[model samples]
Target: MKTAEEKKTRNTKHQKAVLELLKNATKALTADEIREKLADNINKTTVYRMLDRFVEAGKIHFVTGQNGKSFYALCKSCKEEPPKHIHNHLHFQCEICGKVECLPETLKVPQLDNYTIRETQLLLIGTCKRCMNSTN
Candidate 1:
């Protein structure tokens, strides 16, 4: 495990670029999409490492798409000190545009009688407002 100081030192320019891309994105992006948006100098392996680092730092989070592809996005309320990963909202995927985004509302997980809910991931599929508006 790397120390906090080491993690801080590992934040290179390429990592900053990757974070910038996700920060400006309106929706979550896949690994391939992130690599494609980055400079040619950064390779696939390096991109994955950077992503893992960011995830460990609680700077980003990912949700699995319908196709089982992981889409990464910036964490809205994650902490970097102890690294807290808390996502209480659901994910929305626009079927028409093929874009995946995190919804703004908070999700309420149901209470079960005996079942324990460790993790929850919900993906709602339908046409987004942009696609709906474009039709009329």
Candidate 2:
């Protein structure tokens, strides 16, 4: 039987692998995309669960595509307390290629007197430079 420490180590290893995949990705990726790149064959359900855990832990954020498909990206400004994750950044989706990328800039959240904002997602859709250049 595996000891508690061994099990924790195994779990951490898997989590690190998943995080590494997201960190290296230039574009947001679906669970399938992440799974395809992993060296080990991790279960689809496990991938989804890991994604959820990461989101809750403020390590990543999810963006829903125009077609309703969800993609995950790493949170560049994650914090441990107060605001666990920052969602002020904008996401750009290439309408032609259906690729999603996180822009380096951030948007200011409007202040409401009696409202507490949990998160905000802004998705901008357009033909990316690569696609536009390719068409010429």
Candidate 3:
């Protein structure tokens, strides 16, 4: 087993890279994009592996696009030392530009007394105002 400091160090490195990539992104990105951003410093396989680990660790989260591609983004708000993206937030995908936008602090998922709720995936796809207005 690894020591606490070792784990922290690893997490710090992962979070650093994730935030750096997100800081420069206007929309969500796939593991390949992340690998491209990191260049030869890391490979595509390792980027995917790191993404999985970060998602599990709550440092990053996934959102699916209209094209069915999985993209990642940093949480708007995070808990724990490294911070985790809230899973209950809304994800909006613009059909025109293919931008994935997160609508957080909007709504808390509803719970039913008799319902055994596990998880939810909601994606609202449409042309954004910018796109729609541009057509006119």
Candidate 4:
């Protein structure tokens, strides 16, 4: 019988591979895209499970596109101590190519009376420069 720590560490290869994929990706990648880039023969379900674990661990963040597709990207502000992460930035989704990218700008959360905000996600949808240039 393996200890919980051993169990978590044992199945870390897949998680490490997925984290490397996200770290190298310039834009957010979907699970299918990640699977296509992985060297190992990993299944879609496994990829999704790994992604879910990463999200819980604050190693990555995800955005749902306007087309209903979810893309994952690394969370640079993730801290291992408290297992917390900050994702207070805007996400841009290209309408034409369906690609999602993180905006460099940060969002300001407004203060409300007697209201508490847990999490916020700002998604801006439009044609990306690549798509715009190609059309022009």
lDDT for 80 in candidate 1 is 33
Compose the digit string of candidate 2's lDDT tens values, residues 4-56: 99978867888999999899898999888998998888789988989998887
lDDT of each: 0.81, 0.86, 0.72, 0.81
- The TM-score ranking, best first, is 2, 4, 1, 3
Best by lDDT: 2
Error of 2 at 38 (Å): 1.0
List ranges where model 2 is wrong by over 4 Å: 1-8, 78-84
Model 4 regions lying over 4 Å from their true place: 1-10, 77-84, 111-116
Query: Model 4 over residues 20-106: C-alpha lDDT tens digits?
Result: 889888999999999999887878898898888787777788888887878899987544422324477899998898889988888
Q: What is the C-alpha local distance difference test score of candidate 1?
A: 0.81
**Model 2 Cα shift for residue 14 (angstroms):** 1.5
On lDDT, the stronger of 1 and 3 is 1
Candidate 1: 10-residue stretch with minimal lDDT:
77-86
TM-score of each: 0.76, 0.86, 0.71, 0.81
For candidate 1, write residues 29-130 as lDDT tens digits: 999999899875567888888888887677887888878888999986544342224566889988888899998877776778997654457789899999
